[model samples]
Target: MLQTESEINMFNASLKGKLENLSLSSFRDLTILNLSNNALHGTIPSHIGSLTKLGILDLSMNQFFGALPLLLGNLKKLTTIYIYEIGIAGTIPQVIGYLKNLLDLVLSNNFLTSSISLTIGNLTKLTSLYIHKNNISSSIPQEMELGNLKNLIDLHVSSNLLTGSIPPTIGNLTKLTSLYIHRNSISGSIPQEMGHLTNLIDLAMSYNLLSGSIPSTLGNLTKLTTLHMGENKVSSFILQELVSSNLQTSLIPPTIGNLTKLTSLYIHRNNISGSIPHEMGHLKNLT
Candidate 1:
C-alpha cells in the first residue's frame, strides 16, 4: 500500500522509536536509512546487518556509543556511511573493508583510536575518506594501498597522532584535488613523486616533523592555489620555486611575483630569509 507524503514523513520520523524492538527480518523495501542528527541512543541493532539493499546509512550527530557494528559489512551495496560526530567509541571494525561499493566513508570527530586497518586498501572505489580528529596514532598504515582509487579526490587525515614518513606511493592518486595530512608527528622528506599530482589545488603538510628541501617537482602543480608546508623543516629555495609557481599569495617567496594571479600569500613563521623581492611591486594585487 502506498502511503501519502505526510504519512511517509511521519513514518520515517517515528521509525527509530518503532525500531527499538525491530528484528532485522521484518524490514522490506527499506533501502535508505538516514537517522542523522537524531537523539537515537544505544548500540546499533545487530539485526541491521540484514538490510542487504541499503545504499546510504547516516547515523551522525547522535549519542550512539560502542564499536561500529561489524555486521554492516554485510551490506555489500552500501555506498556512503556517515557515523562521525557521534559518541561512537572503540576501534573501527575491520569488517568495513567489505563494503566494496563504498565511495565516501566519514568516521571523524569520534573516540576511535589505534592504527587504521590495512584492510582499507580493499575499498578501491572510495573517493573521499575522512578519519581525522581522532586519537588514532602510529605511522600511516604502510600497508594501506590506494592505487585502485583512480577517482579519489579529497583525503583528510590531520590533527591526529600519526607518525612516520608519508609514502611516496600517495602520488599514485593522480586524480586527487586536495590532500591534508598535517598537525601530526609525521617525519621524513616530502615525496618528490607528489609533483605527479598535477590536478592538486590545495595541499597542506604543516606542523609535523617533516624535514628536507621541498620537492622542486612541486613547481609542476600549475593548478595549485594554496600550499602550506610551514612549521616543517623545509628549505628557502623550495619556497622560491613555489613563489614562482601558481601560488596566489603575497607573503610567499619573492619569486612568487611570477604567479601574477596570486591574491593571498602566507609564508611567515619559518627559517625563510632574504629581503622581499622588489619585483613584487609589479603585482597590482599585492599593493
Candidate 2:
C-alpha cells in the first residue's frame, strides 16, 4: 500500500519535530492535531488517548497546564475542541462525557473552575458551547440535559460565578441564536419560558440578580436584534410591554414612541419619568 502511505507520512513528519521533544511516543496515527498558538508547556499527553482518529483538536493558545485529558474521552471522532486561552486548570473532563461527536466546544478563556458537568447532557451533538471566561460557580446544572440540543446554536455561558434562575428549560433552545447569560450571580423571574425563543437574535440578561416582570412573552421574540435587559430589577409595566411589542429597533422608552421600528434606545438609570415622546420627534431613526 505504497509503503503504508509512506509510513504514515513519515510518521506525521516525525511527530511535528518531536514538539520540542516532549515525546509522548510519536502520536499514534494522529488526525488533525493543531498545537494552537503554541508556547506549549506541559501536560495534555495521556498519549492523547492514542489518537483514536481525532477529528480536530486545537490545544488553544498554549501554556498548557494540567487536567483535561481523561484521554479526551478516547476521542470518539471529536469535532472541534479549542481549549481557549489555555492554561487549563481542573474539573471539565468527566471524560468530556465521551465526546459524543461534539461540535465546537471551546473551553473559553480557560483556567476552568467547576460546576457545568451534568456530563454536559451527553453532548447530543452540541453546537457551539463556549465556556465563557471561567471560574464557574453553581446553579445551571439541574442535571443539565439540553433536550438533545436540537442542533444548538451559540450558547455562551457568560463570565462565570453562575448562580441560579433563567433556566426555564431555556425554552428548550429551539435552535437558539445567540443567548449569553450575562455576568452571573443570576437570581429569578424573566423566564416566562423565554417567550419560547422564536429563533432569538442576541438576548443578554445583564448583570444578574434579576427580579420580576419583563416577559410580556418577550413580545414573542419577534426575532429580537440584541435585547439586553440592563442592570436588572425589572418592571415599569414590563418596560411598557416591551415598547408595545415592536420587538426592537429602538424603544428605550419615550413610551418607545410606540416602537415605530426603534433604532437604539437605552433608558439609562431608571425611575423613568414622562414627557419625552413628542412621538419621539418622528422616528427618523432617532439620534
Each candidate's clash count? 5, 6
TM-score of each: 0.83, 0.33
lDDT of 2 by residue, 175-250 (tens): 8888897888888787777778778777777778787667666666655555666776666453323322212233
| TM-score of candidate 1 to 2 decimals | 0.83
Alpha-carbon lDDT, every model: 0.72, 0.68
By lDDT, the best candidate is: 1
Which clashing pairs does model 1 show?
243-256, 248-262, 249-264, 249-265, 250-265
Angstrom error at residue 88, model 2: 6.7
The superposed Cα distance between candidate 2 and the true structure at residue 30, in angstroms, equals 1.9
